[model samples]
Target: MEIDFTNIKVIGFDADDTLWVNETYFREAEEEVGKLLSIYETPNKIDQELFKMEIKNLPTYGYGIKGFVLSMIELAIELSNGSVSNDIISKMLAIGKDMINKPIELLVGVEQVLSTLSKDYKLIVATKGDLLDQERKLENSGLLKYFHHIEVLSEKEEKNYSKLLQHLEIEPSEFLMIGNSLKSDVLPLVNMGSQAIHIPFHTTWQHEEVSHKDGHSSAFKTVKTITDVLNIIY
Candidate 1:
């Protein structure tokens, strides 16, 4: 579908996978946690339990490395029937710390795309995660200066995007969101009458994956890479 972007004034980018490596670290941490608990259950069973724990705790912890670490601790306790050792718990903490300290590796052409688009559009970051962590990554990314605004949303539903647009004093039609998650970044904006573009990453969290039935609308476009955005907007 040929969608129009002539009226797009504000371009919003999702920070994690869209700009830099994020979910990759989470996967690595999950593997380490699974191994840590392998004495209690098989690696596959451990992975499933951890995922269930994360989903159950989503309301309480929201999202981010801190929440993930806490879930790991909780899972460890449950799996071991409270017999898990302090040393093991400490190792879980260390896994999270390592993840938090992982180097900020930007996806290809991220800086170039941001640099080019920032010149013609009011660029902003519309992402969901722990506020402090997201801010830290943004600071570390060196791409913070390109964004006119940064929003760390609690969720990325229609209401959240609506509120963000309202706060920015822009019409839904005037905003454009680009990210790797069709569920969080694309469908919600499209449903709210805003434009979006999907740039698939190598990996995606299970929670963020969406089906074709969910993204069948013509209000959004999907490109292979971030730089393809320039071809559409330019």
Candidate 2:
């Protein structure tokens, strides 16, 4: 479907996989967690249980490496029948710290796209994650100057985006969201009468994946890379 962004005044970008490397580290951490708990269960089972634990803990911990690490620790104890060693717990903590400190690697053409688009649009970041970690990544990304606003949302449901657009004094018809997650970034905005472009990363969190059938009626566009955004908006 051809989307006319001619009326889009404010373009929101999702930070994690859309602009920089993020979900990749979480996959790596999950692998390490799986290996660390191999004695308690098969790697596949461990992974499954860990995902369940994450979902269960989402309400309490929200999202980010700290919450992930806590979930891992809890899973370890439960899988090990409360006999998991402190050493394993310490290793999990280290994994989370390492993830937090990973270098901010921007996706290809991110800066150029931002640089070009910022000239004609009000660019902002509308992402979900721990506020401090998201802020830190933004500071480290060196792309903060290009954005007119930065919002680290606790969630990315329709109401959240509605509130954000309202707070920014933007009309839904005048807004566009670009991101890698259909669940968090695309569908919600499309459902709210805003335009969204999905730029798929090589890897996506299972939680963020959605069936095309689920959003078949929502008007949105999908691109292969961040630079491709220029084609639609320019």
Candidate 3:
């Protein structure tokens, strides 16, 4: 679909997979969890239950590595009928720490995209996760200097984007969101009359996925990489 970017004054980018490697680690963790708990349930069944646990705990724990670890521990306790061993729990904790401590892996063309766009448009990060973790990532990414602001939202809904636009003191038409998820980063802004570009990541959490009908809408543009933004805007 042809999208108008002429009115966009602020560009919001989703972090995690949008900026660096994120969902990939979670996928790895899930696989590890499956192995760790395979004695209690099948790997596939454990994987399914873990997702349910995360969704159920989203309200209470929000998002990030710590929350994910807790979900794993809870599932262990449940699946093992409270007999899940301390060694298993400690291993799960190690997994979380390992994930957090891992070095940031920037996607191809992230810096070039940010560097080029920041000069012309006010760039900001509009992502949801543990505030501390996201902050640490931005600090380590060496790309923080390019952003005018960083926002860590609890959820990426229409209301959240509205508040963000109000905070930026820009109208919806002046804001353009770019991210991988159509559910979080594209559709909400499109509903608010803003523009968005979808750059699909190699990995995405199931919860961030949308139905084919909703995802096929012509309100936004989808690109192959962050570098493509340069062509779209210029």
Stretches > 4 Å off in candidate 3: none
In order, candidate lDDTs are 0.92, 0.92, 0.95
Candidate 2: C-alpha lDDT: 0.92
* RMSD of each predicted structure: 1.1, 1.2, 0.9
TM-score of each: 0.97, 0.97, 0.98
For model 1, what is the alpha-carbon lDDT of residue 117? 95
Provide the lDDT at 112 for model 3: 92
lDDT winner:
3
Cα lDDT of model 3 by residue, 1-234, tens digit: 457999889999999999899999999999999999999999999999999999999999999998999999999999999999999999999999999999999999999999889889999999999999999999999999999999999999999999999999999999999999999999999998999999999988999999999888788988999899898899
What is candidate 1's lDDT per residue for 100-204, written digit by digit as tens? 888899999999999999999999999999999999999999998899999999999999999999999999889999999999999888888889999989899
Q: List the residue pairs that clash in candidate 3.
A: none
Model 1 spans with C-alpha error above 4 angstroms: none
Per residue, candidate 2 scores C-alpha lDDT tens digits across 133-206 of 99999999999999999999989999999999999998998999999998999988887889999888889887
Candidate 1 global CA lDDT score: 0.92
Please report how far candidate 3 places residue 219 from its true position, in Å: 0.7
